[model samples]
Target: MDHIRRLLGRVTAAALTLLGVSVLIFAALRAMPGSYTELVLGPLATPEQKASAAASFGLDRPVAEQYGHWLRNTVTGDFGTSLVTRSPVASEFADRLPVTVTLTVLALALTLLIGVPLGVYTATRAGGGRGGAAGRLLSAFGMSLPEFVLGSLVVFLFTRYRLGLSVGTYTPWSEGPLASAGSLFLPACVLAVFCTAATARTTRDAVLGVLVEPHIAAAVARGEPKGFIVRHHVLRNASVPVLTLVATLSAYLLGGAVIVERLFDVPGLGSYLVDGLDRRDYAVVQAGVLLAATVFITANLLVDLLSGLLDPRLATAAKGAA
Candidate 1:
């Protein structure tokens, strides 16, 4: 009963959050200077032409009515047609979302693959050592470098050295998984840089904290195998905090992907959103923002559920609150 109640509460909250985001997205876009009709018709268009266009687009309706209509259509999975392209926004998103998802997944996998191991090594060698110093230095450098700068550097180096790697080209999954991964690998690395550094630092701290706990010392005293202790005791206990950081960073990757996608010329939702904004396509922008928010909210909710599973105390606390 408590779990059911908690789940209901989470669902309710998520729905409300999405509603608020939709309101903000609608209002902000409306508040922006200029109208889609004007952009479409040009300054040479007469007042009668503008009025007809506004009416056709339903922009002549009251703000509340416009919002209500948009909300209703969106509830029915009709995200409306793009103002610029005259194509269904939902179809556009459907086409591009997979690209973004693939990129994000690749970047996250790289982050975990590199970050977790480096963190474990650094934590074990926390006491002054060349290895620890080098790890720390690397993390610091990664955190300091901006994604754009790093991406540009990679592009420049690849071009200058004739590395023969595909930099700004995207390959569809229809070709092959390996080709798709290869095309996205460089951009994924760019997206992963800062996240990897942050994850490593976070993991190092969590592991270090867990390492000093009494249970760890007791396990060591009992002559438990080093690998067994580290795996069952250290990593297990440190996972909660690391998991939370990973969830947060994963959500952040969505936003960061916008810039990275542009740099790589990937046909992702990020690039779609950029094109929408550039052309002031309200439907496209609104759909993109709403989808991004939904994904973020959903990820956080999943993380919370997973965290509860990982730490029984959290579930107990939630039950008590329920």
Candidate 2:
């Protein structure tokens, strides 16, 4: 029952956060200087034409009424038509969302695979050894490089070396899964570098904190194998903070995907959002922002629940409160 209540509360909070995001996005777009009317009809459009365009787009309605209408339609699964493309916003999202998701997921996988082991190795050798120093230096270097710079470097290296890798091109799944993965691999690596550095540092700190606990010393004195002790005791306790950091970083990955997508010419939601902003396509931009917020919120909620599962004290506290 406590778990159920906690889950319900999280879902409610996520819904409320998404609602706030929608409101902010709508109001911010409206608050911006100039009019979508001018962008759509051009500067030379007559006053009568602009007025007609505004009315047709429902721009003449009161701000509150417009928001209310948008909110209601959104609740009913209607995201409206794009002013520039005349396509349904939902359809546009459907086409582009998977690409962004794939990039984020791929980046996260690489981060975990590379960062967790590096962190563990560094933590185990934390006492001023050369290995520890090298790991720390590498993490610092990875974290210092900006995503665009890293991306450009990767592209230049791959192209300059003629490494037989495609750059600045997106291959759809219909072409072949291998080709699609190949196309995204470089960008995913670019996105993962910073996340990997951050994750490695976080994991190292968490592990180091766990390493000094009395139980760890007891296990070590009891003649337990180093690998077994670290695996069963060190990692299990250290996972909570690492999980939290990963959850927070997922949002960063999504946001970074925008610039990476543009740089690599990937036709993902980030690029779609950019195009929408450039053309003043409010519907596309609104829907894109809301969808991204929804994904981030949902991911965080799941991570919170998972964290509770991993740390029984959380569930115990919730039950006691209930």
Give per-residue CA lDDT, model 2, range 124-149, as digits (tens): 99998899999998899999999888
RMSD of each predicted structure: 1.7, 1.6
* Candidate 1, 11-54: lDDT as tens digits: 99999999999999999998898788777788999999999978
Error of 1 at 296 (Å): 0.9
* CA-lDDT, candidates in order: 0.86, 0.86
Clashes of each: 0, 0
Q: For candidate 2, what is the TM-score?
A: 0.95
When summed lDDT is taken over every stretch of 10 residues in candidate 1, the lowest stretch is 250-259
Model 1 misplacement above 4 A: none
